[model samples]
Target chain A: MSKGNATKLLGAATLGLMVAALFMVFVYAPAEATQGDVQRIFYFHVPLAWVAFAAFAITAVAGLFYLWLGYPVFDQLAYAAAEAGVVFCTLVLVTGSLWARPIWGTWWTWDSRLTSTFILWLLYVGYLALRAALADGEQGARMGAVFGLVAAADVPVVVVSVRLWRTIHPAVLVTREGSHGLADARMVATLLVSMVAVTAVFGWLLALRVATLRAEARLRGLAAELLALERASEEN
Target chain B: MRAMAAVLLKDVVVELRGPMTTTALATVSLLVLVVLVFAFGPVWGQSEPTAAAGALWVALVVSGTLGGGRVVAVERERRCIDALVLSPLDRGGLFVAKSAAAFVFILVAEGFSLIVALLFFNLAADAALARTAAVLALGAVGFAGLVTLVGAVGGRAKGRDFLVPLLAVPLYVPALIAGVKASADALGGARLGEIALWLKVLLSCDAIFVAAGLLLFEQVVAGSE
Candidate 1:
């Protein structure tokens, strides 16, 4: 019923799902016939990528609302979502690198998806930096909103152009034998569970960050009111 | 349309009076090409077409960020942006005028850069050069639109000269990748039809940046923080 109870329930659910996901990934799912243990990172990697993209979408949508409605809350939501998105994006890059080094035989490749994801990471980092650089007020928020909207629009083009670029000059080291597909039902189930678990983690993290930002905004508003009241009382 | 043209004329007149933005763009682009020549092992015609194409684009991006932001930054010197915002001109028209001015400046700079690239990289001056020039022009359209939009905010902040490139470069990646590939193909004597896909990407990027700039420029310059 209460907000605190909802958050506690969310935490408990996230913990339970993470435990289930870990067990299913290591114990329930069978190893691949080819790539073996290294392939297991896909469970975490794919979900992290999914959640990061989703988080950025939230940031952009929230920014849109902030601009349209002129609300501080929406700006706070955008900032919180961007922070969480960056965390997940960083993990995606790391797990991807770990997987790539053993499999693709390189620490990094300019593959379309990898390159798009890297650019996405850079764009959001720029977003965060822009916010940090500007004055903390309506103007900063509006500028951030505009930037978020434009960055979101830029992403698909990035994906398409990078794909075209890579395909035009295919890398020599790509030894992929087949599609990255799961042929087994058990693997599918494990991936499904992992996806749900990671998403739950993201939801929980986003809520916590948003709440902290809201509270900070509220505190600043109250402090300003207090200062005004003190000044009035002193004059009286 | 008349208001947009008038604003554009104002920008052009100012630019021609001083020629600061165009001069900066041309000079910086040439310097970047010189740096790239050194970095890429200055082998003249022996170097691949891709290397030369890549170098030219790097020049465009580096100098475009430096000079394109100035297109709007120039408005901030005497608080001219506040006056413009309060003027009867439509915000979208303002965006279009600024971007168009940036587009022309970039084209001029690109012309200089391309000529230097031909000599520094030792490329032929035939149909291939024309095709490459066309490709660079299209790429400039998108870059100009983007830099103009970002310049509004990037110019207002502290340490803005650094801020402009920081904010624009990542968003410019798709255009950079597409432009370099298309130019390289053109330089390699490939027909225009062969690089249609890359050209399409550039066109799409141009459309999105222009559209986004039109829609968001109002909020970007609405008020002083």
Candidate 2:
């Protein structure tokens, strides 16, 4: 299938899954006794966090490929993924904060999880800002790729920070005790479904964004070629 | 190696002769002091000597970031970066020399700031002061090296003034955490071994950044050209 066809299929699948997941969240999944309806936001919030991290990881890998192979396609893909990652990361922060306000009684806290997410958000925002501000295309990609790879070192650091700092936020998925909290079959199944659904959505968004960036690059290249031709003709 | 030495010496000589950069460094140090006073004043009163020691290191890192950014951004602005790239010296060696120059400059600034902090805050000399100074040196070296590479990359960017910090600060976190822990231990008069964990973290980060910078420097410079 063509890229467009694949994208369309993926988009359709994403919308379908998202609707199904939302229904499951509100109507099917049982509410926690400790937290009420607000807890349902976790279905979307956690998925957003997962997809954001996945997008950044992809950006880093693409950056490495661009540096190694000097491929413009890889650079463009990395840029697109970083942009998408920032959007998802912002969603995670906002939704997480919203959930926290009702449950934790505070909109913001410097708990390790939230702090690391905030830092991650800032890193990508800076990444996008750097890309937007740079004028030279090739040069910008080179710089951006380097920054992407370097900045990615934070992912693992962020993952390990809570362990290092002994902070309040629980490591919901990583730690053994936290895993026990989700031992319920229904909860685990629902979370897994949500993860898959969000991953599919991220893949779909990335495909569309990459296609758009490639089209823009091609237009710019053609414009540069035309400008060169005009200059040559005038010289003649 | 001698070529690298020459590059390093040239930067040091230029800096020594003009001293504008040093004065700027001092000014940044003062600004850090003011900022720290504001940040920590509520918790530990501005008159507390120990707080000043901790705050001094924070100031050093901030000033180091600004100074490191200027080192390469200045070269790019003057159209001299291309000349540097075209020179026969090894690209990795160039990275090392520039990073060394930045490291030394920051160390000097940190030393001056420490003295200022001691005087302003009435800190008494203790074993902790020595240990804290050593940790600051290690952290400063690593921080300067990383920021130098970041600044070089940012120099080729369109909004370098904005890009350098965005690229550098997040990377500075591990170092900042380690530096603060080490400083706190020292200020509390702990043994060198007491802060060994933080020291190891700083050392590992330093080694990683230096290696990455060396490996990536040529690609970054070539891409800039």
Per TM-score, the best of the predicted structures is: 1
Between which residue pairs do clashes occur in model 2? none
State the lDDT of candidate 1 residue by residue for A1-236, as single tens digits.
Answer: 98778988999999999999999999999998788988899899989999999999999999999999988989988998999999999999999999999888889987778888999999999888888888776788899999999999999998888877778786766635463579889999999999999999999998888788888878878999999999999999
For model 2, the stretches where C-alpha displacement exceeds 4 angstroms are A158-162, A167-180, B45-50
Q: After superposition, how far is residue B64 of candidate 1 from its true place, in Å?
A: 0.4
B114-195 per-residue lDDT for model 2 (tens digits): 7777776767677667777898899888887788889887776676777787777877776676677678777777788887
Q: Tell me the deviation in Å of residue A70 in model 2.
A: 1.4
**Local accuracy of candidate 2 as per-residue lDDT tens digits, A1-236:** 99899899999999998887877777777776566667778888888999998889888999999999988899988999999999999999999889777766678776677777887888888888888888636788888888888778655654454345544335333321341255356666677788888888888888998899889889989999999999999999
Off by over 4 Å in 1: A175-180, A234-236, B42-48
CAPRI accuracy category, model 1: high
Error of 1 at B2 (Å): 2.9
Give the TM-score, chain B only, in order for the candidates.
0.95, 0.93
